[model samples]
Target: MTAALNIYDPSAKPTAGPRSLAGLTRPQMLEAMKSAGVEDRKAKMRAEQVWRWVHHHGVTDFEAMTNIAKDQRGSLAKAFTLARPEIVERLVSVDGTRKYLIRLAPGVECETVYIPDVGKSGALCVSSQVGCTLNCTFCHTGTQKLVRNLTAQEIAAQVIIARDDLEEWPTSAENRKITNIVFMGMGEPLYNLDAVSDSIDIMSDGDGMAIGRRRMTVSTSGVVPKIQELGTRTRAMLAISLHATNDDLRDVLVPLNKKYPIAELMDAIRAYPGLNNSNRVTFEYVMLKGVNDSPAEARALVQLLKGVPSKINLIPFNPWPGSPYECSDWETIETFAEIVNRAGYASPIRTPRGRDIFAACGQLKSESERLRASARKG
Candidate 1:
């Protein structure tokens, strides 16, 4: 018999110390303040004031929170920190895609990406784990060993750090460019569900960044167990990293399929909370040269996703060093997309962005560890 799983309770009280503002949700902050004896109405007023300054105004210093009493600011600063992850390196692609290597405290790091397109809707890809544990065969991120799960502070900092570089204020909705957030950058988002949930809540809260729940997406590579809870808690759009069709091939492509299998994974996906035509799931299929790019495979994909309300994102394989797969020929990819389109599913062939700087899809590797390795040898 299998042992019971130990899931961390997110609602537990935070320990007293230097807590980062990036980590706390609006409610969590309120709770923290109350725990620290800010339970009365005046205390609640102080909590709201601090929340607005930290999130709405994007104040990096507690002292700059002018609305709060001067004495309270000093006390808050002594107890908490409005800290952001330091950018160790920032690279911008010719296509306006920007990738940042952010350092989280000592010996911790992650990458975040911003993709600029024709529309005002740009996507910010955020990382969940410091390194990936899934180790999907075709992904470059899977090459590195799993370091650790990013804290809620680390996860939230990715958004704050991006907004800082983009000069984005929550108030400026008219010229605001970043319209979407995707947990598609580095590790498996499901593995770090607590942090991902907490971070995204801050992103979607109306009083702060104000991104709609529908605009946020959490991508998982068949972490079946967490799918239902994720749908219930966040209710953001769900995206599954479903690169292959059959269990036999999927086991090799995405090794997690070996444990969960397609049948079990599909069962969980079908039962996902808030699933309907209005809130459809996305199936991301990366087309490899002659491997999974055949018209037959496309038909199989349509059949597999029969009852689900979904859009198949037909992605051409983005190659990296030592990658075994090559992108499918344009004609092959087109043929494959035609089969799915005819099957009444929207199969948009995703355009590869930031390939020049390797910031495109499936090409993110943490420069944090690479730089450290180089420094040690020197």
Candidate 2:
């Protein structure tokens, strides 16, 4: 009998080059099909048929598409591939959070996380860049220098990988493990907005993966220029990584605030295409020990978001090795949240998931592959 899939297998390797059609958008699929010598009239129809199999059902092999004829499948296979990246390691947290160290190319890696019991069902936090450009002081990922931006296909492949592991094939509304997608992983998503936007289109297409745009939230560390454009293009929910209330504190906590201060950031948020109670912008506030988590600060947060509909996610700082911060005292966090709760906003002290596995918020780093290389050399 075959051995069970080793979720933690370290020898996993990537399918090199741009041959994989698994993460292509609908239009991209059409282009690939035409390039594969699919006749002009038949290309559109064939692309649609194969799109369902690749995305809706998460089929890796063209042969599995029984709806398409054998001869065409052979042609398609010769033209392109549908291979997933190397899952260098998969770690599962006791709390049901799953972290994946995925290698997209040689020397290019990023982490994707699936947190269970979030939103309606669960959320997959996918990285947009290899490391990070925004060095938010409290975040562990911020400590790593930026490697590069992930391609549209590379970004979408994270979802594809999660779906494969979860065995959530043939997308359905019920019994779904990942009902939402959050761009709150290793990188500042806005830095790679174009790929982030295209990947959203691929995953959210009703004819394909079918997760709604509203359920896919892109969290940015306040990229003022792209905030409105991101809303206009993707219609995905906007989440600002606004850790502190004022410019001075925010500058220290989120250094990007120095370039685009709280006032400017808020202005961009307020002008976000569809601002209302129904579609409130999320403000992620990481509560650090004796740092930004004060009752007065919470009140100021309420005032800062006076007119705009907002949900403040008060995250208790998840510490990392040699990190410069500690989580706020439980009572201090509760007190801070209480002030925001008194306001007309939803302020939930985000329960730390995957802290034991280093999969919690702002804790993701993709050094596992390097560690594996060192062990191999030894």
Candidate 3:
């Protein structure tokens, strides 16, 4: 009889197999296939076939590509993997919001969320990094230590997994349940620019998933250097997580503000490509009670955003365990909104969604990974 090896052996070595193919751009896919011994002409053909199966059909299995020859399909499957990181945990809100904890590699995990609403559009909130570097005071994802960046395939798989749950397959230019995607789940997207850019390119390609560039928004906590590149390259709507109005308070609320102050951040916003009345930039202002949601602050916000064609999303603070902040009073938030509205900015108080499952605007955590890590240590 063969001896059983210890499953929990810490020193057990792992072998590298196929890397993820989730985030490849069309040109990258062609290059990858060509390098893997596929002929140039056949590489293009195979890339299109694989793209259709992966994006349009949402198939993760190589065998599902019916058009590809059986032998080629087997060989491709052996050569390259098309699987998402294992989903570690899943949470569903009372309002049907779904958040998934996905494991990218050993000891690395990230969170992704799916928000559902009737008659209107739904959104998939994806993470760019396993943990966040910004450490925004209002966000739970910021509480964890910064892990390595997720690959483009890992980023793209968040959408694929959402589509898998929603069953919105055979992607088209119009009419889909996942109407929008927001890179506001875990990490600062600007820190993981190359992968995020590559993944979104595949998502926005007309021949593939074809999600509208306008419907997609990449939220940044004022990463000044890469802001223009994001606008010029992606053309996706821009959303800045501007929690505080002044530099001093913002330096605390968003730690990155210490490096690039509000002045520089706003300047970058102004320099963003295609900023106009029709394509107004979105400024996300989280309302914290007594901290930054005062009527004076709201009016200052109006003055602060002067000459910039923009709207504001007033997000009431969503509290979590051991958080330092509290949500602003309903009347306080309303009064604040009124001040901005009177100043010609469309400041809408965002309706709280997915709070029951801790999937609200600022309430996302990856506890499953923590538990798994603990188990391994124990």
Candidate 4:
């Protein structure tokens, strides 16, 4: 008879510290259970129970997993941890938008924003990385250098934290404040694909967060190679940060366009899997004054997106300190929208949300640097 190995031996010094089980997918969680000395036959069942508790019930404490055996729960506590990123600061805008400065680890922070009344339901903007690699000229986050990619657990924790704040527990549809999630925060998501994909899977799990795949959109700044891969892996709604209509201007606006120009980006968009009229791709156009918001540019945009099912999201430029561009005048924006609207595409001017809190589009920068600066002053 083989004796079971004690995974949580009190006197034994652990080789590695406890692993966080928060953001793990079902398969990954099963593997973790097997690693923790759970029998192969029971690992899947055990992982399902734990997954329901951690994600569905939003229980952080192993002791609260009532269905799990006490001995196993104790073992899980020793072998794993369920934690969300620490909320260093949470600011609520007058418009009911909430921005969280979440500290992933010491000195590593990211911003998550909750915007109310998107499609009559609230939406949470989640970050995939601590900072961004793309130096999109107008973006505040681009000014900050890349720190590191957030793990799947860190990404999923943003949703968990927001749900906790909203008091939308038990995962009921009626009380759901955050029905949609947009990966449009600090970092470029395609750069951190695996973690983002896994995190989305966790968020969209029917038994847990229960957010539909269609309600979750992953916005990319045209990472060409990863576009099709993202479609295959996540199958979530796609949004492009398409600020410019032409390559020359786009090369300056979004530097990634230098490598993957408008033509290549359009090609990738055309090839995206599961794209149809109902699941149209979104082209986010920030209306920069005297930049990319002309009637000719709008006509050019319609021409470029020809035969592609898409919607144009005209965002008024949200200014940050030292930003060179200004938002287009309301009349100019309306005219630009008219061209796209006349072309049979929906072109809605996105109202700036969380602007007071600096949580609007292109305004997410970590507070860690500011906090460090203050510490140095003292």
Alpha-carbon TM-score of each model against the true structure: 0.91, 0.93, 0.90, 0.92
- The per-residue C-alpha lDDT of model 4 at residue 321 equals 78
TM accuracy, model 4:
0.92
Model 3: per-residue Cα lDDT at residue 88: 83
The TM-score, computed over Cα atoms with residue i paired to residue i, of candidate 2 is 0.93
lDDT of 2 by residue, 1-378 (tens): 221111221122235543787888777788878878889999999999988889898998889999998998898888778899889989999999999999887888999999999989999999988878778889888877877777788888999999999999988747899999999998778777778888999999998889999999999888888888899999999998998888888999999898888988899999999878999999999999988888888898999999999999999999987789999999999898888888878999899999998999988888754476469989
What is the C-alpha lDDT profile of model 1 across 1-378, one tens digit per residue?
Answer: 221122334564335547776556777787767766665776667777777776666788877888777887787777777877689889999889999999875676788999986235798999988778888988888987777777665677788888888887653457777888999988888877877888888888777777788889999998888898888889989999999899999998999898889998899899998889988899999988878888889889999999999998988888987899999999999999999999899999999988887888888888866667569989
The alpha-carbon deviation from the true structure for residue 101 of candidate 2, after best TM-score superposition, in angstroms, is: 0.6
Q: Per-prediction RMSD in angstroms?
A: 2.9, 7.2, 7.5, 6.8
Off by over 4 Å in 3: 1-15, 118-120, 173-175, 369-378
Would you give me the overall lDDT of model 4? 0.87
lDDT by candidate, in order shown: 0.82, 0.86, 0.82, 0.87
For candidate 3, give the lDDT.
0.82
- Tens digits of per-residue lDDT, candidate 4, 131-155, equal 7788999999998887787777778
Q: Report clash pairs, candidate 4.
A: none
Which residue runs does candidate 1 get wrong by more than 4 Å? 1-18, 31-41, 118-120, 371-378
